[model samples]
Target chain A: MKKIKQIFYLGIKGSNSFLAASLSAGNKVKLSGLASFEEIFRSVEKESSAAGILPLENSLSGSIYEIYDLLTDSKTFITAETEVRINHALMQKERTGLQKIRYCLSHPEVFRQCRRFFSDNPSIETVPVADTASAAKMLKELGPDTACVANPAAAAVNNLRIKKEHLEDNRNNYSRFITVGRKLKQHGNKISLMFNLKHVPGSLYKALSPYARLGLNLTKIESRPIPGRLWEYLFYVDFELNNGKHGFDEIITAMKMLTKNLKVLGRYDKYDKIKNS
Target chain B: MKKIKQIFYLGIKGSNSFLAASLSAGNKVKLSGLASFEEIFRSVEKESSAAGILPLENSLSGSIYEIYDLLTDSKTFITAETEVRINHALMQKERTGLQKIRYCLSHPEVFRQCRRFFSDNPSIETVPVADTASAAKMLKELGPDTACVANPAAAAVNNLRIKKEHLEDNRNNYSRFITVGRKLKQHGNKISLMFNLKHVPGSLYKALSPYARLGLNLTKIESRPIPGRLWEYLFYVDFELNNGKHGFDEIITAMKMLTKNLKVLGRYDKYDKIKNS
Candidate 1:
């Protein structure tokens, strides 16, 4: 078995994923870029020490249910959680002014996010690429009259000069990322779990009664639809353990008896704890 | 103010939205295609009789939270509910064999969904267009060698011939759509409401106890994060009142006093009920 000090993320270098991976792994582990989300999980699953960083949800866009579905299917377990503030910056090969650029290259989603910038500067023609990272890499390749919108990390990685900062329409946009490892972390202040309730009236309430009775703080709760089953849903819940893992085992034992197909996704501290530490 | 017998949707003719709008509005109303979701809501807000159809959730992709946010901000309410079985078909200007096709035009999402089809036939190059509807519109312009992936409706609308059906990798994929109108739907069995709690312990359980007490069946329950509020979330719950509008007024009065910012999004029947009737 091959083991390396590497963390995998989706997309090329200098993306929001790259930034989050860099932060989550810190300077100890090397960051590796993969083509797809599934590939990242595959790499981590193969090597136990390696980790995969996936953007699970965005403040504005909501949760990435595909990743949740992937997490359910994969043998990996969540170990850590982090947040990356999305800041899209416009850059070019040369230090050209906004008026000098004729073509602006970016992902279609990025273009939509920075809609106001283009509407204000109607002279710039928008070109959609596969991703923001590629857009930055293609800045010089496209020509001197072109600019690309990407993360500031991309500006450093691709050696492009920043023309504008915070180009997104909403400044409050943030993506919550999770680091998935082969083994679960047994210690943390918060725990994430998912379960399926039996098809009976008040089953949902009965399942939730444990948390309310034990005074467990449910930070997030959402029900996701099961594909072939039509209206039947899988519930994903996250709660904070106030007493610092006091009843972690007991809670798990209690929940296992109450719910069906109960899966403990992870145990981790909130983003604030990591930020403060 | 001018009002026409038109029901608006997001994309052009022959798209999934168009199919949903058609099923929702029936043959009496002319299905109109709009450029954006916001525009459709705006049009309906101006004219009370007019309605807009929006895709709310996909069995595979999950809920479109942006639409939920829009619903929270807008005056419109969900008047009806319908489901559209997503069927992507390969078509072209002429009835050409799969071997004759050189390029396939479709929305990037459609191309991703039909990844298996392209992988099986490596000779065909995928061209990512704006949408499936426009892909069909551009088929004749792109020539006989070029094929497009879209709904079967596009084949009839654009005067093209379908070469293959069920091109998507997952045949069971479905999108649930909701018709939003100016006034509340007064007589449907299921009711959708969203509320924010006062940040107290057991507030969620307390809010849910009402349902358990009455044995109300909760079809769907989801938590949507409020942007800029960090961890706070607004709960969206859909419950079926089996007694046929019995205690409807009393429950509204009871919940009004129990919850904060409680907004009754709509009253609508299940898709199965509509499909059968």
Candidate 2:
């Protein structure tokens, strides 16, 4: 019998990261949990896990910047990518009237997504916890007067009763997750890279022009402050090209010449959007 | 006697926004407090306040993206700008040893800046509140066992003892603020604008080229999702040119042709960085 690879994620059972990890690895892998993104990265680096899964960005709230900062300094490569449609559910230990619930607990990011719900229930005191699943667990321990906003899967895992479904203000909210490991998977058409360009007029335009000239599709571009350097930015870009293209090497060579520092993070398949069954 | 203009900001008496508002409006203006950015905008729109002050970006943590999104949707023009040096301090009601402090209260953004302090005292429980000044007020009510991370000015306002000064990991942290009002302030050299380009391979590069061609210094660029449009972005840009220069009208006309939707948010003077008085 073959040993199953252990996959690590940030949060307890049934959190979004856990669901993303399961989707990325399938049934052959065993899922484990860690307390923080730092811990998950350390576990993967130490060979205790096959890959670490993390949410990279959310459609409504924007990018998970800490993960972006971590990617800049870490040697890990993105192995896979997936998207999870976020469906926040309000859960409690027992069935109680909405007016009776006095406290709400969840991760701060989840709170931002449920602004409408919070505004409607202004009397409910909100408390931030480490993660959504942990909030569900805490709600279970706190009993009837307390509730939490998390996923339905988390409510099921914690044996809590769902009081409200689709609690997010925007039903279109989706989180994009990426799996990181020691080696590149190298099978996908989409490529992600980070680079620092000289601060000058048209420097970014020059650095990005080669892709445009090559007729490549630029999907996303983001800039973060280079650490210890005020006002200087490191740009992260995602672009797509056919893997069998002939001039890919020449393009890479040209990009290197245009940038002061550049690193190819990974090439990975774009996850197909999973529609509701 | 000249009627005093009212300025609104987020948080209580001694928050960073309060200080920024004071610095931007000068002594002749009366300062008012609001609970959130939405309220500030509403007050400005309703003509209850002469202007609204908001933090646009931080050097260490990147953009205050919510403000960026608000600016994109708002008709209010940026009339003035200033930079405030951030100096976070840990405060308590009494002189208590660091080992005795059990709870830490602060705004979530402040917590991110004080990661080193949190890691050093891992046992301290962190609680998120609406603003740093409110956190200081809460800490005072909670007595000596609790400490809050806020500016030294907040500590002075709330009558809390500063247990530790300069708690932020990076001393270079500074927040740039912009004042929004009904009319543009035309005395300054810097101009801010927001626009949307048709999404394509080189759309952003094309949109940004005019500034480079005219030798205008591009100071900042950010993108936020156009409301109700998935994956489409509205770009915010800041550029500087000599206020007395010729061809300004021609540059504006050319830029208008390049973008689908364009609006000049404001033109404002660059704030001189005050280095510890």
Candidate 3:
């Protein structure tokens, strides 16, 4: 039994709600703290943790690049992954009815996440809060006249009543969360690397050329702005290969000679579809 | 004289801080209402606006694509342009010393605007408020312990005192604000367009090849996800050319069949720098 005492998360209010449910579902990992990106990184650096969960990307808003940067910056190896289906529950204090709810409090992302819901209900004012959790906290503190569209967890934590559930217009809405810890765990079938190729034209194509020849399917290729480099970028990629294989070695060798700052984060299993019993 | 009574803005908090200063520079144009991107568009659709100011792009944070979409979605035309040399002032209630400040409030954009500032002062927690003006509003409501990095106007509006001025890490920080109204004011000489090319290999290059050949310098190119079209994008571009014998007609001709849905919002001159004098 892994006595997972502390799990640090940098996420929205609903993230905490979902996390609480997840933690309870698993080995009862104790909720130690909730911090923003910077704070969370600082804490992880100082202490050991069972897992640190952070949002990597959203379906609608594209990627949350900052979180990705932090993951690389801290050198914390991604240990596991989780996917929480986002159901942005529109809620207020139990006392406040739908008519009395004047303002909708949410993080800008949450407001965006629930764009269709707001478009359908254009009469109510939607105010961007700092985070979904903070909005939930504020609603609890400010009371019923103000409703919030956030995660079920946020409503649970903040003690607000959900007036409406699954308010996110898209039923397939989901955010991918990555769990990182000190030790690298090999799932034995994936390679994730971040690198910057020389910025000449076709450099991206050139870097991927070797992989293409080997028939290695590139699962993900994301470009993030390299600090201090104008228009140049560092690409984080997840390719379907392991460190031990001969083909993987050839590709890695070619990539190293062909790019700048080639870093191998780890080899992990590709997250296939979630299974249900 | 035009009695421009209302100003509608599609921005997060702190976004209008610089503009707030400009608006406070006179008493004529009052901020009638504040709303998100969707609300602002709906309001403008129902009636004409005095001036609608929206942050078009940031040097560091790329472009605000939603605003561009709003511009395209409506018949409102770009009338004037302005640039605010951003100075993120850290403010708290008058008497609160810097050491006493625990939580920092600002828009997420402003938080990114002043990332280094917060990093250097690690003890202070950052709370992303919705609007720069609202950050000030929150600072005033929360009082001394909370400081915010916002525009001087926000400080003035909320009656908060500037604990420290020019707190943004980047000295060259500026945000371009576009003033949209019903008709082209014949002031701005630069034209902005939104269009999309076929999503084929070298398609982007082919689209821009004409601009490079014609000696037309592109001021900006930003990609916005085409709604419901996975991975497809609409490119928002600003091309600089005087409407003269050098007829933009050539470039228009080049783009005639090359791109899809090419709509010229309006042509206007780059703004004269706003003066405190």
Candidate 4:
């Protein structure tokens, strides 16, 4: 068996460090430093790392555009995928009560999840940190008076006491992460493409007509702003098509006539939740 | 004219508050407490407020969904509108040095705008507060050691010093605010509506077909997730059909058959820099 190379994880704060540690499991895949999308991309481009994991979307906050834009702009291809179920907890140092937490540190999303907790305690000021793991790090450094709202893994990793567990508003809160590398290898059975339609009425409907006519089932479609254009949008679409040669060619031909700018990001199987499931 | 009552302003942390204050002009309308969509909705519904001014969209951040959702859900009517050129600034107390500042507080959107500024100073943490005005309030309470990144009005309102200004990633920053009340007495030329088409192909095409047929030009269309539903969306549309009587019923009838759900929020004349254009 070929040896697995070093993997670097790039994400926008939160519990990415904990997730990376879990993904590594008992393997010898040494986890590199946790960095931002721009930093990780630079590292990958300069051959400083072999593979990197990035958060594609969150259940509550929707898409992380920075990573998406970086993914599209880079020559990397998604190699593997995983979903991390986030169980948010309010953590502080040992022997501290909830009322003693004068300052709360967390990401915007975590702050949003525990809105009720914060609302009930209006006197406690909430501070927005860049990442959940970093919040834990800071909480450990700041000691008992400062509590951090982060995942249990974050609390455990930083040796902080979990004051309150399962603080997320929704029970099934999850974030999907994708591994991107310099090579192209399809493991899953799905094709993802992104495109932009003209800023006119029925433009999106017209663009998707051929697919609907051919009985192609679209799995997901998300629209994000096209920078520089005040209100224009670009749609990212994922769909399931046959993996064989004939079925693939026909879809490409249909896509060609649908929009002016078409980018076939990759074709891979749906990233299933096998490990945690 | 009748004595104007209190005006409820839905301040967007920084720029919108200044624009709203300026638009109130010499009228008897006094700026009530600055509030967000939820706060404004609850305030106006219970109080005797005359008008509510809230932001609809910004050039960089797209639409403020909390305001839009409030507009659609509440009993507010469109009365007037205004626009403001946004200029974000990094602010602190007069004598505080940039290096001395340990924490920076602002709205999440403003924090995003000045991400580059924070990138340069990795040691200083960026914190997201309720709004720009609130951030300024915290800065005043926390003293000079904690700086705030906000608008000039926010700085003046909270008595904070502007350490640095115009800290946006993009130069052409602008935000549009709308005035809504329970009465349609004030005139406007634009109509805004929201609806949902069946998830099939060409549904949106057929739904928008009548607007083109009636020669009524459509201005804007935006989509937001239908709360508590997966794989479904409701689209918000702004259009030009100010005639009030002609072709309104027919256009709505055509759209009903082509869509699963349709809701007309309100209608008004084109936003005149001050009143209806």
Top lDDT model: 1
Q: Name the regions of candidate 2 deviating beyond 4 angstroms.
A: A1-4, A14-16, A107-113, A127-131, A170-172, A225-232, A274-277, B1-4, B59-61, B107-115, B127-131, B169-174, B223-232, B242-248, B274-277
The lDDT values for all models are 0.81, 0.76, 0.64, 0.66
DockQ of each: 0.51, 0.37, 0.13, 0.23
Residue-level lDDT tens digits of model 4 in A1-277? 1244666664423366446545643476666665456666666655634667777765544555566677788887666666777777888877576677789888765676666778888877888766677778877668567888877767667787888787765554566677677765544567777787666655666677666666565655656546456346677777666445337667768887878678777666675552231
Task: Report lDDT (Cα) of residue B79, candidate 4.
Answer: 61
What TM-score goes with each of the models?
Answer: 0.92, 0.88, 0.64, 0.76
lDDT of 2 at A208: 77
Quote model 1's TM-score: 0.92
lDDT of 4 by residue, B108-163 (tens): 66766676878888878887665676677677678667888777777777677788
lDDT of 2 by residue, B192-251 (tens): 887886656678777777876776666666666454564567777777774566355666
Q: Residue A38 lDDT in model 4? A: 63
Q: A38, model 1: CA deviation in Å?
A: 2.2
Better of 2 and 3 by DockQ: 2
Compute fnat per model. 0.40, 0.21, 0.09, 0.08
lDDT, candidate 4, at B86: 79
Candidate 3 structure quality by residue, lDDT tens digits, B1-277: 2445667664533446335325432576655445566576566556553666666654444455556667887877776666666778888887576678899877776776577778788889988766677777777678567788877766766677887887766565566677777665544457777787544434555566666555554555445435446446566667666445346667678886678888877677765554220
